[model samples]
Target chain A: MTATLDRPTAAATGSVVGAWRAVWLRVEGRWTWYRRHWTASLLASGLQPVLFLAAMGIGFGSQVRPGPLTDGVPYLAYVAPTILVSGLITVGVTEAGLPVLSGFKWKQDYWAVASSPVSSGQLFGAELVWIALRLTFGAAVYLVVAAVAGGWTSAGALLVPPIAILAGVACAAPVMAFAATTKGDGHVFAAVNRFVVMPMTLFAGTFFPVERLPLPVRPLAWISPLWHGNELVRGAALGGLRWWPALGHLAVLVALLVVGIALGRRAFQRRLVV
Target chain B: MRSDEAIISGTGLVKRFADFEAVRGIDFQVRRGEAFGFLGPNGAGKSSTMRMVSCMSPRSGGELRVLGMDPDRKGPAIRARIGVVPQQDNLDLELTVRQNLQVYGRYFGLTRKEVRAKAVELMEFARLTDRADHDVQPLSGGMKRRLTIARALVNDPEVLLLDEPTTGLDPQARHLLWEKLFQLKQRGVTLIITTHYMDEAEQLCDRLVVMDGGKIVAEGSPAELITRYATREVLELRFPPGDQHAAVDKVRDLAERVEVLPDRLLLYTEDGDAATTRAHDRGVRPISTLVRRSSLEDVFLRLTGRTLVD
Candidate 1:
């Protein structure tokens, strides 16, 4: 009896370590799922962005081109940052709200994770990191396609990648916090996409310059992370940075990222530990 | 909290959900490495108590300590040492079986390399090594449950909590699950399960508590409870409609106890054969006679005064 009693004590530490390794395994597993049915992810994230680049870059770029939207450059270069930033936004928003909720309600995955040694903060943090990595993949794809389409300039355009990532985090961070508290009939996520996402996409200058909007509407654009990403990525592409405003904009993104992280941690504990 | 001793201890445990009281008040201890069960029909509040022990839901009234620590104050610490198999599979349908184990391991902060090694080990343990790479959505129900168990053990918890682990499964699946649970118990993993099926309670639980209307009706080993609360043998008689009462009076003196119902007559006694013989000697013949040993179902019925909800 004594010998048997001592066995579980020895196994406890090993189990703790084992539980810690489980989070990334979830992401690796998701990769295989995506590979087998690549079209599903492709339709939602990859091909849709590619099509946006084609339609907006070629079709929409035609009207604004040989003019001044790109300041004598091509229209593709003008909208490239917007597409990249918008790409990140879509990932963060979709991943944080509906997908996270699915983990709670549809699948027992979150409960399974919670039952392990893992803290709610760790789970939330890991998911956000995974979401960030996914955004990078999507943005990189858009950037490569943009460069291949004769839209490349100086190496400074590399700024679009991080800016795009920031935009996605900016949009996703607060929404993730909000999603943890929501308990409606679930169709509310659709409304968020329509009202929140669509307006951010349109007014935050996905297709045009925010400066072109009326003064009152521009403030709404200013509040959006898409605008900052649009500003930074567009600035880097066309070499148009006002040092103070650009620095200020980056700081806001960083601040929001921190707030999102803090809020996500609190929300996860509240929902999971309940 | 030792492996061979009680790891979970509770005193005056009570759980209340607003105006309703799910677990009004109760106290139980689960020794390490024993297959303990909370057997009850629906609304018996078994699930509610389970939620408290799991550290998922807060205890409304009493003190609950698993692994010798209060879950309310040290939630993560307690959960870290426990493995939980919820009533549902809850496996990530979007991932492969291997990924499910790995991701669950990562939530506890395991390194990538360690998670990989552990995933392989768990898949083998779950008997799903061949299906390790297959999507979870396509696995059979039995396979899913095996995976869920495998996922729960990813952390090698000190106490394993399973709520109605075999509820919806077919007999073959339930038996397979029982076999797996038996192996866990053999390895000295403390098990706490809740089940409505008395047969499952008999087969898996070493000791269990019978619950009805949110209170414990009885608690003991399967054999002890059956003997204490039920007859040693049960005689079931089916008669052609209106003749059951006449047959009942003739057999009433043959047994220690008798219960008459709309469908059948049950004679409770120490010797069913002797009782049947005496009934026959009295020329009270029935359409059918079934003699069998008393089981946990009979005990549950005796204690609860109600049939289980399917």
Candidate 2:
């Protein structure tokens, strides 16, 4: 009976449409895994952000009277948008780092997919897309909860989720490029969390103005994508962002994202193709 | 694209890692519906060659074609037609058995509906319907291996590439896998397999190449290779371990060739019974004796001077 089975026919050619479909296929795989295991990551990506908002925006806001740094706004409102961007950045970086390494070294699921019709470039693009989707979901949840907590003082705050997603891709793409180069047991990912992500979250003007930082350390925020995202999110949410500076921040984030994607594509091809 | 043309053909195929050459200038052809094999020990370049053919690894230097298209320019196109089961089962431990098949099918551009149906059929083929919804981590080694094979078939590939298909499987599991593979062969699917097991090669391969030190040392049907490199039958004589050298001197001229192993001495000749009788006439009886037909193992040992599995 098995002898009557016909061989599966191959696709006619590697057309552009086929390539795009392959990319979405990888995205679907990631979505499948996310659906099954998302609860394990919910605390880190979802609950932790809300807890931070509660502790820092409400608890800490009550201690600080309205001031210049707060732009005469309540501390909860001033800190809400910044936390939204920072939280998405955290989720983005976390998703792109160790998981990317595990895809290559531990689980080797990347290799398994690469053996099929999917190209390395498509795999890299799908990873960034999945990270962006995750960041979008996490940021949207945080925005709704913050709004319920009275953190939304301006109608412009509605734009923060999309901006937060851009910040996430900007952060995640570069980390994924670096992650593709890692062949170890996640020591690099741990080091990145400790040395790069933690410091950036604390010092990227999330809670206050960057000018108050020590002069030498202040430039660090200038180069941080999170800081630019923070400024944009806060400006849009607070209704006082100057047009030129917001455009400048957007340009920097876009430039970083482009460079990150280019590097990541090349790195994935190098690691996966051989 | 002619039906009579080779499905995979390579000339001067080479793969170098850093300064080390894993596949040194080798050549071969695989036709449609033929079961071909690469038989070698670990690091003998079998996996490297398989990777190159699968289009997962670009050739360091070679003129290669799969399905009549250049791999360098048409890897995804070529890969879409071929299935690969890697040496290590990289099944997603977090996903259920069914999801693993579904996700892999999607990579080949199969739609959700198509993959769903294909996954169901594959679950039946792999005999994992009972464990279809279970996580892959807790499944036994045989189940995982079978699942990997079933997943590769999700696309119904015209060619299936299996790397050491049953290396770590138990005897029963190995037999089951071999049975499935034989079924695949009967369906006229071109199979490219790499295994260090001579029994597996003999059982499944229509033609095969023996590799050692990154080179193809011999290539033919298993029977042809055995006839060319080994005697028709082997006489195994076990003596005291320390006295094997002495026994070899007594029975040296009785067979066409002799191999001295740690625990036994093998006398290779056209007739094992004659060789054993000759050994007995020489008054060299010390331990157990047995006669068996020559197999691919003896051929491999003759060509490479080393065991396939070490």
Candidate 3:
């Protein structure tokens, strides 16, 4: 009892160090869970990307001809960076979907955390930071595998992983905001995957260029974070993207990331604080 | 803080939801080093009041102070100094039993070394040292409740608030939990418990408030409440179907009060044996008769005109 009385009130003190320490504790919880379950995630985020690089770049590359649509490069090199970008978008959507839902509804772990010294906004911020770190690590592994498979045509391909992280979090933040507001079982997540995630992955120019699609459906690709992500990755890896167009893509991804985080933080407070 | 000051106090405290009011305006104070309770039925706003006191929910209207701080302004700080065990078990099912304690301690800003030591100590206190590495999902109901209580103690909080701590446990488990709570009280950790069990209130709380329909109907110690609102003994008589109403009129003049139920008639009086004799003298025949001391259950019945558990 004396120890309790003598302890400093870090939560009320409101220092920068104390605030960051609160958020770091929540991130450690995610890291602990990941340490125990890394193998399953490695299979999905790591090995699966290499297999797609092999099947689409090597096996399917044999029939494709290098032309204006291919950026005059081989199919393997052409598809490698964009596939890495697309894979991370998928990872972001996966991370933001059922896991966020379980934290609020199924497991109610968010309420448990809310009862502690950590605030609801801090919990949401910590989640975004953890996802960004996970996406960075997964992107590094895919880059190594892509390099070994001769997926890059230039030295600038090394810059693609960081850009992939931006797009990944850009995709994760809004999805996390949506998950925080929803209730009940995970059928809504399935609908998000089918109607939202899959369409962006397929039509956002992962397998082919967006110009190949009909004019009416082309604007759908323009609005997707995956398309902006693909443009940046393709330019960085293949070395033909101009500076002005690259800035436009960067701005889009950043706006999406910022807006998603704001919405997610508000939703978290509504669900957990009450 | 002085020992004489109220550890917690609420004056005209009210909690209103969007469409309905949960805790109507009420006032209460809890002194240091004492066990306090909110005794009521399921929807009597006990949990709502507990939530407000725990700093988890904002008060709709009124003044509340915990540890001399306003909950709305200092929620995180107030929450840091107090422990909370919610109605349901919200253990992290993904973590092991030991990991659950260690990780939860980190939320309170404990060092890794401190959390490690605290985890070992708390696991022993909860009697969960043997199952330290097991996941929380497979634990029994009793083990889960014990673990929840142990987790709440990680920060060595000044006040521990438990909402229906032993609601679904068996008799053996309930007794074990009661013993643990008694030990905590002995160590001078202020305990605030909300429960519907009359025996639990009698066994744990030094003073309690009886709540009904979002209002406190009465407030006193268990013996004081039973002595004031009820007679010394209750005489219960079982009769045939539809015969209780007839027996009520015949025995109405014998006791202080007569309560009719579907299966039996209760006669409240100073002496149950004398009441039974007077009913017998009135030519009223009962199939069975029982005499017992008045309890908190009888007090609740007298105040609310209903049973506590029904």
Candidate 4:
């Protein structure tokens, strides 16, 4: 109080592009929080993916025969890229769940940000960006660990992290839209874990090829964004992806991400600005 | 062209929530570098109006302007030049005290270097330099409120909107906060505050509007409103709890007006001593009697026929 500074003229910065820059600024806020608590998130983004690789890929792979279903590759090599994508998806879903609820309802940090120069749409974009960054970090850690575990067969495996990030966004965007509309303490996140994410991770060709599943339930794997992501990452890592099929899987993930972002923007606007 | 002096102006502003109208078309203007206040009870739409001015809530109808820009279209632009301290402390509890200031500063497009320097200045200004690295969750309510005020100042805003700035604060904390606000006023920061405490309005507000039932019932400076709606002094007569009603009938004509409360009767008059002596001469035999100068509380009660706070 009674303090003075060289106050700059308050013309809105960047006019048109300022909104986008504000989105990054909001992401920067989350990054500050993440920098302090990244270790806490390590168990979810790092350890869990490595544990799954050890338990399902290496431990269980030792018993299974090298067969045509696994395309003559070792089980650890076959499942490594898929688990990377799965780990990102899990991180995406969890990030979009309670944290989104807290932003809207409990903590209301979204409202606080909206009170500033940032718009609700920009804030939503920033949240997705933060989630994407987390996915990228998780994917990087998983890729390094998997590479050391003899999971890499081709240089195309380097493309897995980006593909995993796309998969995470595809899963995160819609769940964030749903989370934006929630009012309770996020009990639905548990249901999303048990009924949606867990099943998708298990049945979407992470452990075995979807072709091995019963035909009736095979459509679920086809419909799951995780499966498309797994296909893209595995095809890239294993160097077996056909051109048209790969494009089709990429298109599906992109469509889901686009639609989810559209719906998410509307939900956030209603919750924050309205 | 709009007047540069009028930082905030609203005409026939209305706010409705489904079936209920929160603000029923009120008009007001706040000039540059002046402390303006909305004094109202809990349901009196002060917060609703504040939200609209802050550009966080869209108005249901009518025209509103902040810093000469329409809030409906220029929300982010208008919000960029102003700071808002909401009724509740929405400070980021997970972040350290300094981080809270740094993060909020970045939202205004301040660079990390600028924010860091400003955070240091603000921490010192709020007298929280010692708690700079500590998490915000452990700070006292006064510290949080002070930090919020400091955060609001990060943008060097042209106007600062504070809703119930010291509602839950203790007496000493409230005084400290008021001292800070008074300093802000001295520094030429336009302040818009909403509170039910008459003393807060009288102490901080250069001018204020008394609102009730979604409408402004009175508008003037504290002393002006007191003079217009209340007497210069008031005499309080307590004649046992149950006898207050009976006592009102005896001293009804002794003062300009008589108000009967549960445990006491208030006599509004220009001269409290004269009224009290006249009441005693009439054999009123009051259990206790006291005279006090009229306050904004008297003005509010006279305008709305109820206490400012329930």
Scored by lDDT, the top model is 4
User: For residues B205-307, could you state the per-residue lDDT of candidate 3 as single tens digits?
Assistant: 9999999999999999999999999999999999887789888889998889988888789999999999999889899888999999989999999999899
Q: Which stretches of candidate 3 lie over 4 Å from their true place?
A: A1-17
Q: Every prediction's TM-score for the first chain? A: 0.89, 0.94, 0.92, 0.94
Better of 2 and 3 by TM-score: 2
Assess the local accuracy of residue B35 in candidate 3 as a C-alpha lDDT between 0 and 100: 90
Best-to-worst lDDT order: 4, 2, 3, 1
Per-residue alpha-carbon lDDT of candidate 4 for residues B34-122, written as tens digits (9 for 90 to 100): 89999999999999999999999999999999988999998888888888999998999989999999999999888888889889988
TM-score of the second chain in candidate 4: 0.97
Across residues B41-126, which tens digit of lDDT does each residue of candidate 1 receive? 98899999998899888888878888888888877777767778888888888778887887676655567787787788777777
Considering summed lDDT, which 10 consecutive residues are worst modelled in model 4 chain A? A8-17
| Full-model lDDT, candidate 4 | 0.89
Residue range A115-194, candidate 4, lDDT tens digits: 99889899999999989988887787888888888988999999998998999999999999999999778998999999
Mind giving the per-residue lDDT tens digits that candidate 3 earns over A1-274?
3343235322221111266777788899888878877887887666666777888988898789988889999999999998888888888888898989988877878878887888888899888888888888888888988898888889989889999889999999999999998876878888988998789888998889999999999999999999999999999999988999999999999999999999999999888866
- Predicted chain A of model 2: TM-score relative to the true chain A? 0.94
Estimate, for each residue in A28-110, the C-alpha lDDT of model 1 and write its tens digit: 54565566676776656655566788888877887774556556778887777678788678767887888788767776467
Give per-residue CA lDDT, model 2, range B1-310, as digits (tens): 5555688998999999999999999999998878999999999999999999999999999789998889899888888778899999999999999999999887877777878888888888889999989999999999999999998887777889999999889999999999999888877678999999989999999999999989999999999999999989999999888778889889988988899988789899999898888889899986899999999999988987777776
TM-score of chain B of each: 0.94, 0.97, 0.97, 0.97
lDDT of 3 at B97: 93
Q: What's the C-alpha lDDT at position B82 in model 4?
A: 88
RMSD of 3: 2.7
Worst 10 residues of 4 chain B by lDDT: B1-10
TM-score of chain B of 1: 0.94
Whole-model lDDT, candidate 3? 0.87
